[model samples]
Target chain A: MGDHLARAEDFENKAEKKLSGWGLFGSKFEDAADLFDKSANSYKLAKSWDKAGSTYIKLANCNLKLESKHEAAQAYVDAAHCYKKTNINESVSCLDNAVNIFCEIGRLSMAARYLKEIAELYESEQNIEQAVVYYEKSADFYENEEVNTSANQCKQKVAQFSAQLEQYQRSIEIYEDIARQSLSNNLLKYGVKGHLLNAGICQLCKDDVIAITNALERYQDLDPTFSGTREYRLLADIAAAIDEEDVGKFTEVIKEFDSMTPLDSWKTTLLLRVKEKLKAKELEEDDLT
Target chain B: MAASDPNKLMAKADKQTRLSLTRWSADWKSATVLYEQAANGFRVAKDYENAKIAYEKASKGQEMLSSPWDAAKHMESAAALAKDLRHWQEVVDFYRRASELYMECGRPQPASDALAKGARALEDSMSEEAIQLYTDACTILEDDGREQMAFDLYRAATNVYIKLEKYTDAASFMLRLGLAADKCNATNSQCKAYLNAIVIYLYAHDFIQAEKCYNDCSQIDAFLRSDQNRCASKLLAAYRDGDVEEIKRIAQSSVISHLDHVIVKLARKLPTGDVSALKAEDEEEALDENDLT
Candidate 1:
């Protein structure tokens, strides 16, 4: 580690001298950038994350001075990775800088990928609201670049978090839109039923049985294969069960569905929310009578 | 008797026991000695099945000889073998039997320990039975004038009830724990138990019960002076006034947030829906109108 640190310092000093040295036709910036990159790598080898991150920033600055936007963005991304374990705020800011540079350089795909990375970082921090915002932006960029699969991935995250925030309408719309979009592509068609199931579950969270029934009908019409899927059957059964205020049948349907294809935690949380609503409804009716 | 092998020793012990049973005058003392020796030999050989049986027979013989402490020791050995075999029900039974034997010898602490251990062994497979054993153990400690020792047992039972989603039962157990804590003069534990009970009741949407719990806790001198008491009073007031924002504020307040995670979670879930709270308010208004008339 000590050896790496000394070598890193030597590289940094060389880079600084190159930056200040008179050169032919501004060739010194490129030399400085190369030396800074080496310094950053050596610092990374030493496990001095803070020093590595700052050296990468210097490399990014040199790349910017050399009018190389792509290299500058890559340098920022490298810096972000180095800072990720040490400082979340610094990492996020670096990624933001990288995304902006990628966008400015007409690299929309790279910009969208970095945005998704930012959303993931926020999600890991349990800042779901901020995560949703970045994911939405990433999804928009991915959609503009005609990358439907990656866009849908970000859209799913946005929908999941929106549902957790009790914004059922927003979640249902995203899921329904994604389901509609996926139905046309042969490779994406198989996942349409799952998307529809998530949309229906969001509708159920609103505690509106009629809306859920209508949405189920719309989904069945949108994809001919959807009504045949287990996701479809589970949603239809749950909608009926909740309509009749039958908690036992609701549980039984969920149990039966889980026995075949296990529900994920997101689905389980949404279902529990629906169940709690049903219980509240039951208690209200009991009180009225 | 000179046989060094476990199998041979067990065989000799069995033969001697059969001979004693058949005789008009039973040689109980020699039978007991042979059973203990065989049990130890089987234990050394790692033959738990034979060891457990030998220990049970030895325990029975010791009981007949009016040596209850020795009987308890053998029963404990049988219970250990049952645990090693993963026979959970048998483990519970043997330990319970050992606990009873220990109690007969006037050793309440060991009796309680035996019951608590049995409860822990059965907690996963048979939670209700575990709760029963835990409660019995707590009662033994309480009767033996060790109220502080019973605190964790009460807490364990409450946690099991909470896991089972029996919130009312959990709250009741928390109140009992509060009483136990109070008797032991453990002021912090008493306040926490009372506060947890109130939060649990509110989480279960039993505002009436929550209010009742708050009123009861406020009568305790230690609880009345505690920060938990103030939190509970504010929460109840928020519920009574049907103030959703106030409830949320109280849930996130420093006092409530610094409590147990389970209690914090329950506080955060304090019902925001107006249905139940509105209904309670309506009833209160009607009562006030009647009083005015």
Candidate 2:
């Protein structure tokens, strides 16, 4: 690591000297860019991510000076990758720079990919709101390029995070729409049951039994085969359980489903919340009686 | 075991095992064991065709024994053998069957994964069907509240559509994506989708549709305040006014520049004619002529 660092510093010194003593009509920036590139690689080898990132930035500046927009953008992307281990915010900023340059150069797909990387970084940092923002941007870029599948994936993340934020309505709507779109495609037909189930669950979370019932019915209409699935039965039974104000039945239904197919924590949490609401209602009714 | 040649005997034995399962009194365990042994023998002989058949028989026996997961695994093996033989259709069918078996056992994640794998296997040879599989896989995961896992499936499907130049379908999907994003309260994504749709419309020279998209987006409070909305509205106004320079100016603006590459390219191609206003003028002229008549 020390040996690499020494090499990096030496290269940096040479780049500075070359830049400072620029001869007329010489490709000074190009030569400096090459030196800086080597310096950045050495820094990376030394595991000095911050230094590598900064060196790449310098390289990008040189590339920009030489009117190499694509290389400048690429350098920025490389810089972002290096910064990712050391400073997430810096990495994100570097990526943002790369995305802008990519877009400027009409590399929409590349820009979109970088936008996704930015979203992922924010996601890892637990900055959900920011993550959604970038995911949305990337999804849009992907969509504009006729990359529906990629866009859908990003949209799914946005939906998932929003659901976590208790934006149940929005989450439900997105799932329902994607589900509906999937139905027309033969390969996607099998997934309709799962989508409707998620939408049904989101509906249940609103704590309106009638609305949940209506949504379930709407889902049935939307996907004719959904009524035959285990997911449908589970949602229907839960809705019945909630409507009857039977906390026991609700628990029983969840337990029955859990036995057959384990529910993830997200579902478990949402189901528990529904169960709590049911319990609250049951107690209120008993008091009135 | 080698009375008639082991490979031929194994192939014949798997067929007989499949045929013998007609009666309820037949023992599925013995049949499954025999099929597995035959499949292994065939695989050892490098006879993938017979191995695939034997695995299918084994999968059927497992299904009869009420072990859908094991059945799915056997079916997956059959699918893999079929893939090795380059039987694309059989690979898809086996994967679908395996996925169904997994779904029957209430393991949606694996079920979805199986379909995705099938899609991947078919991607090079049969892109259209691969997209179908991908879409199915994504839908399953999304429905199961595992949308996070289905992300790549969506991306793969989109890439296929773009490769096929199904721009209209892709654009419609983008609109749907926007709506989904809107539901998630992802303001930026929603704005981008709306703007993207408009750009696609403009790219297609559907100026009237672009205007309609702009008007629709302007209704949303978040979009109304978004930079994307600002960029879209400016471009639309420039189109209406037939201000070529203004269109050029907006298209080159930092805001538009930061948009997706496709949108940027489309924006650069926006017609300088009075597309929206000309239609309005023609409509007005028609009304005036009708009144005179």
What lDDT is reached at residue A118 by model 2? 99
Candidate 1 lDDT, B143-213, residue by residue in tens: 99998887767877776787788999989989998988988789988898999999898888887788899
lDDT per residue (tens digit) for residues A124-171 in model 2? 999999998999999877864546788888888887888777889988
> On residues B47-159, what C-alpha lDDT tens digit does candidate 2 reach at each position?
77987988898899899899999999889879978888999999999999999999999999989989987887787799899988988887787677665465456545654
Give the per-residue lDDT of model 1 (tens digit) for A1-289: 9999999999999999988889887699989889999999999999999999999999999898888989999999999999998998999999999998776544768999999999999999999999999999999878645577899999999999999999999999999999876654435666777888899999999988889889887886676446657888899999988988888899999999999899999999999999988888889999999
The segments of candidate 1 whose C-alpha lies over 4 angstroms from its true place after superposition are B1-293
- What is the alpha-carbon lDDT of model 2 when measured against the actual structure? 0.80
What TM-score do all the candidates reach, one by one? Answer: 0.49, 0.50
- Report the TM-score for the A-chain of model 1: 0.95
lDDT (C-alpha) at residue B91 in model 1: 85
